[model samples]
Target: MPDLRLDTTDLERAATGLDAVARALAGTDTLAGDGAGDLGHDGAAAALRRFAESSTRRRDELGRAVEEFAGHLRECVSTFDGTERSLAEGLGGAA
Candidate 1:
């Protein structure tokens, strides 16, 4: 029989990696704080807070998008592997 590879371990790892990255991004957001500690800095504090808010928002969106893309890739790999297995089984049974 011909070799028909249908491994999905890489895709699964990539999905996990994306999730980890998302979690890391969230961690950074948490670390940014609300600028409460710099309350005495006036303008600088407000500007920093604003920058942090926008950065957190963009990071969250980006992380979510990457996770979603990774999920899609994993699903596709699963479908492909399942289909390959089904085809192989059918052919084996016929033979």
Candidate 2:
């Protein structure tokens, strides 16, 4: 028979990596200090400023999504670890 034990180390590592990715995504702010704010609030420059603002908002939304994904991954790993433990204990008793 083959050994089918669940090893959670890989999942833990993946969760850690996902967390790091989330941090990196959140840390990025490409237009944080862009001069769009200095532009006049009229004419074509106004439209450009609006576009920049929208871009910033989009970036924020994406960062939030990635962070949420990381959180979910971590939660799944924790659940999987607990389930693995339960199965192991149950199986040991049956052996």
Candidate 3:
């Protein structure tokens, strides 16, 4: 089988980008609506509150998942780079 080459730099960059996305998602508290009274209708305001709450919950969950995935990607990059370095060193010593 052909050797599989991974660009660790690109992987790390992607993880960084995901971290930014997760941060943005984490800042969705504005969706919860602290002053829904200005909406001028009781039923509609309540419904909007419910929808906002649900959306905020889902966004928070998604943010956590994305952060976890980014962490995993960083770990993979570290492992791959370490293994490559060890292999190269071992080969040099054998020479």
Candidate 4:
């Protein structure tokens, strides 16, 4: 059988990385800028505004999803750590 090791530390690190990514996404401002209207052509400016709106929405959704996943990972790490400690204590008590 292959040795399989599960590391909660690695999971925590990954969760932290995800958190950073979520923060970065959430910090993003509009790509079109506030002066989108000054683009000269109304049609082109309108298109830019639409694209910026859509991108912002998608970025927010993705940020939320990433943060949620990171929370789940942290939960898993906590659960696994508790389980391991419990199991170790049980074994020690038995010995």
- Judged by lDDT, which candidate is best? 4
Sort by TM-score, best first: what order?
A: 4, 3, 1, 2
* Alpha-carbon runs more than 4 Å astray in model 2: 1-11, 30-33, 37-41, 93-95
lDDT for each of the candidates?
A: 0.77, 0.69, 0.87, 0.90
Candidate with the larger lDDT of 2 and 3: 3
Model 1's number of clashes is 0
- lDDT by residue (1-95, candidate 4, tens digit) is 99657898999999999999999999989957566798999888888888889999999999999999999999999988887788788888521
* TM-scores, one per candidate: 0.73, 0.65, 0.86, 0.88
Task: Please state the error at residue 73 of candidate 1 in Å.
Answer: 1.9
Model 3: per-residue Cα lDDT at residue 94: 27
Candidate 1 local lDDT, 1-95, one digit each (tens): 99866558887888889888888876774444565455787777777777877887898899889888888988988898778778888888521
Error of 1 at 81 (Å): 1.0
lDDT of 1 at 91: 87
By summed lDDT, which 10 consecutive residues of candidate 1 come out lowest? 29-38
lDDT of 3 by residue, 1-95 (tens): 99989999999999999999999998767544666667899988898788888888899999999999999999999999888888888888421
Please give the lDDT score for candidate 3.
Answer: 0.87
**Which residue pairs show collisions in model 2?**
none
Inter-residue clash pairs, candidate 4: none
